[model samples]
Target: MAKTVIVYFSGYGHTRRIAELAAQAAAADLVEISAEGEVSEAGWSQLDAAQAIIFGTPTYMASPPWQFKKFADATSKKWFTRAWQDKVFGGFTNSASLNGDKQVTLISLQTLASQHGGIWVSLGLAPANTKAATRADVNNLGGSVGALVQSPADASSDEIPPGDLETVKLYAARVADVAKRLHG
Candidate 1:
């Protein structure tokens, strides 16, 4: 089986929920980057063995959370060693505002992956741009790469839109499939 690891930071539990769903869809291991900077040594090993790495974070001031950035910063040795070279990478994000500059967060993630020489994967699903698009639409628009999950501030856990969840699941599955093809 292709080993995969999802490293994420969630401030309001919304992003964590999204990450858990994606991990379940990918059938991959999970690693949470906490504010206190805690990650298991075994988790690091799992990450080294992983063929794909999926990240989740909430948009903080139009960028990823400081904890996520700290986690990335702590990987400088791996980055210098090119540990993630050719590995697959995908990510999802949640924001309170409809136009919460989520794209900026995605761009930051893509830039980090590129620095690690990783292979990036997009959602590969069409946007819901037409007038016929509905809440039940499989893939909503605006995300050009990976999955962009939107959750309103007042939305409850059970209120997460099906479309965003489906998008995340599809993206995770695609990343896993690609990793298997590349590493198997």
Candidate 2:
């Protein structure tokens, strides 16, 4: 099996739940990007050793949280060394509004991966766009670039809808499968 690492910074907690489910599904190590915008040397070691790295962050102002950006900025050393080149990369994001510009966050992650010369892995599932598509349906958000989810503004971390998590698990599985095939 390919070694996988999930690095995430959850502002409220909804994003943390998604990251946890993704880590569980992928059988990957979970590294929390601190709100203080710092990661231990061990965290960098895990990222360097992993075959896959998945990013998770909340969508704030149509982009990733500031801490996540700080985390990305901190990777300049690895980027300069091309240490993560060719590693499989994937990402996920969540927001309060149904159309809360989550795509911007996903794109930011992809761009960061690109800077590291990593291969970006996308969510391969088709959009569940049928008339019967429910809020609990998989890929209902029509996110192809990455996992995108909507949580109610007032909902707590425990109140995250199941459908969003199901999609996150499935997407992480896809990334793990591809990494296994490529690096196992």
Candidate 3:
């Protein structure tokens, strides 16, 4: 099997919860960017050795927090050397509102992957947009670029919508499959 790593920053544990689910479903490693935006040397090594890298972050004010951006900036060395080139990449983002401009964050992650010359993976799941669809149904957010999750502002990390959680897991599996086919 190909090695897959999920690198993420979570402000209030919500993104971390989603990352955990992704990692569980994909059997991937987890590397958390600290609150100060720093990744340990071991984490860097894990990223260097992984065949697939998944990005995760919470959307704040319509964009990823500065910590994740800082982590992205720190990857310039890898970007310049094409270290991540040809690898499979996937991303996920969560926000407090149904349409909290999560796409902006997702696109940012996709662009970051492109900068690294990685192959980007789409959500690959149809939307659960039927009139009868409920929050428990998978792909309720109708995302195609990546996994999109919405946790109400008042909800705890444990209170996220099940559909969103399922979406991330399925997306992670899709990414893992692609990476294994290409790199395993």
Candidate 4:
């Protein structure tokens, strides 16, 4: 069976919640990218073995955190060898504000996947932006490039907005489904 993994860097706890939820929803393994120190070699091996990789990180200054960038940069060797070629890729980002330039982070992730010659996947669920939509709705932010989540800067991991997390779960499922379809 094809393996799916969630490789993420969470400066704050909010993005970690989304990553955990995504892993649970997809029945995927989780690999947390470290900022304070080196990432485990096992993590790299897991990523190398995965058929689908979901990148998660918080949006900082309208882009991914420098820690995540460092991790990306470290993959230069893999990039040159096309180790990730033909793999499925997806991403999710969270921020303090509703319109926190999250798209930029997703775009960056897409570019990273492209550089690795991987396929990029988007959240396929319909956006629940209708006036009648409630906080319980899915795809509330209308994120197309990737899963977009809103996490108040002051909120704890458990306090993540239910709607945004739901969006993550749905996106996770979609990515897993696509990978399965392709690999099977």
TM-scores for all candidates?
A: 0.95, 0.98, 0.99, 0.97
Candidate models: Cα lDDT each? 0.85, 0.91, 0.96, 0.90
- Model 3 reaches what TM-score against the true structure? 0.99
So what's the TM-score on candidate 1?
0.95
- Residue 103 of model 2 has an lDDT of 95
Residue 167 of model 4 has an lDDT of 91
Error of 2 at 128 (Å): 1.0
| lDDT string, candidate 3, 65-153, tens digits | 99999999999999989999999999999999999999999999999999999999999999999999999999999999999999998
**Tens digits of lDDT, candidate 2, 21-42:** 9999999999999989788899
Error of 2 at 44 (Å): 1.0
Tens digits of per-residue lDDT, candidate 4, 74-169, equal 888899899999999999999999889999999999999999999999888888978898766888888999999998888888887788999999
* Most accurate candidate by lDDT: 3
Q: Tens digit of lDDT per residue, candidate 1, span 1-184? A: 7788898888888888888999999998899887765566877888888999998899978999778888889878789999889989988888877668989998888888889999998888888978888656777745877788888889976678898888888888899988988888
> Which is the better candidate, 1 or 4, if ranked by TM-score?
4
Clashes of each: 0, 0, 0, 0
Which of 1 and 3 is ahead in TM-score? 3
Q: Evaluate model 4: give its lDDT.
A: 0.90
Off by over 4 Å in 1: none
Off by over 4 Å in 3: none
